[model samples]
Target: MSRKHQWRGMMGDVAEKCGTTVAIALMEKLGGAHFVVPKTYTNRGPMAKLGRELAEPFIAEYAGQVVDIPSKLATKRPPPESRFQEVEALIDKNYTAAQVAAELGISQAYVFKIRKAAGAPKISSKVDKRQKSLFD
Candidate 1:
């Protein structure tokens, strides 16, 4: 199904379970708005539950009135000053880049970006030496 139809169906389900007002509010608020769902929703069970409860009521009241979902409300968090430090710490603790990415709910590429930004030595690979290898 199309995303719009899917959204409508989900909203219908929410309304059926929660109430029409709550569902309508949620649909209107989320419709055409770009936001990320935070890892806290996955990490802290109680906070996530509470967040869901808090979301419905406000969603109902604000709905189409809101233009942009604020960072405080949405999952798009502020940039961390210690992102590099966090990555370094994980590496020092013998965590693989993939492990760090899973832990941080980010991608391996993002971990590499953080590693590069920290001025760490690049990981040399056969790909890097390919032309030289071919000539030799």
Candidate 2:
């Protein structure tokens, strides 16, 4: 299904009435919680951050109502198999854990964990071969 269709109920209404950009901002800022829309607009707080153009209509419709915002992860996470495949592909390219983490927007530790799970070869550390030994 299309990403647009995934938004349902109040979220879908917000997307339809306030534009997708505003809806997305709201989701990013207030998802996974019950947000109380103020009866009146003010110069501060979440509504103010959303700006008058978008916030006004929302307040008009949902004021005095506690609206439940969906979690960002509900829409954003890919399937685990796909994620594993992506990590495996990066490993196959000989990317280091740090590089894989940065590229995938995950932690380096997680990349290492994935490497361990996949039984991939250990990433070699960079050490200058010409460095003089302390004992020498």
Candidate 3:
């Protein structure tokens, strides 16, 4: 499929999963000031082609009224308190942050935050001054 077609298909899937109103809200959120069409579509004009097709449903629903979708609307709740201990245990078991985050339905950045807050040791490979240098 063409890239444009793939994008439209993905958007359709999003619409199907979240309902038209939510899909439109999500589109507007991603579109910013342009709103109806996303930047990628506008940048090259392919998205602009489907502008009317996409907008009709949303326009009819809103009756030309302007509305805002709250930025703070939470899609999913924060990982449970026990998740912190789980994160620590997983780290002890050598689980990567990405793995922990995936299992916990949270972001990898959040996993790092939990680790930092828990005083976990940094997992880095810094060359120690006492170690013999390859150049030496």
Candidate 4:
């Protein structure tokens, strides 16, 4: 696939797993925004591309550093964006994306979107639609 196509595909897989809109998640993910837990994708191609993108900012700093040190401080580091941190904190002990939206007072669709964008699977063991609110 073309490079753009690869990024798009990787972005798609990320969108599918993290449960947030593709655009939102991709911006956070590709823009070097970090998360409490780095998301991984089932598809390798896209994942590799994203990994490279993420590493670009760090390559220069760590160019000749010891194994323990990163070449540089990643362009963005020390606590990634909080976009998904709230939701991540609400995940079940099993690391499942359960009861996040209800707890955060956000749309379940958005919750699902973020989780999927974070690399959650289609077959989440999570309880879907149970967190719905009248105001949603």
Considering every candidate listed, which one attains the maximal TM-score?
2
Candidate 2 lDDT for residue 18 = 64
lDDT of each: 0.51, 0.71, 0.51, 0.43
Go through the candidates in order and give the clash count of each: 0, 0, 0, 21
Tens-digit per-residue lDDT, 87-115, candidate 3: 87776666777888888787798787776
How well is each residue in 47-79 modelled by candidate 1, as lDDT tens digits?
A: 233356655454444344423322222223333
For residues 87-129, what per-residue lDDT tens digits would candidate 2 score against the true structure? 8777667777788899999879766766666665566643334
Question: Model 4 over residues 1-136: C-alpha lDDT tens digits?
Answer: 1123223333433334433333343364445433322233323433343464443333332333322211122222232234566676566433443455666665576667766667755435665545687687
Number of clashing residue pairs, candidate 4: 21
Report lDDT (Cα) of residue 73, candidate 3: 26
Segments in model 2 whose C-alpha atoms lie over 4 Å from true places:
1-4, 77-136
TM-scores of the candidates are: 0.33, 0.46, 0.34, 0.26
- The alpha-carbon lDDT assigned to residue 98 of candidate 2 equals 86
Q: Pick the candidate with the highest lDDT.
A: 2
After the best TM-score superposition of candidate 3, give how far the Cα of residue 128 lies from its true spot, in angstroms: 18
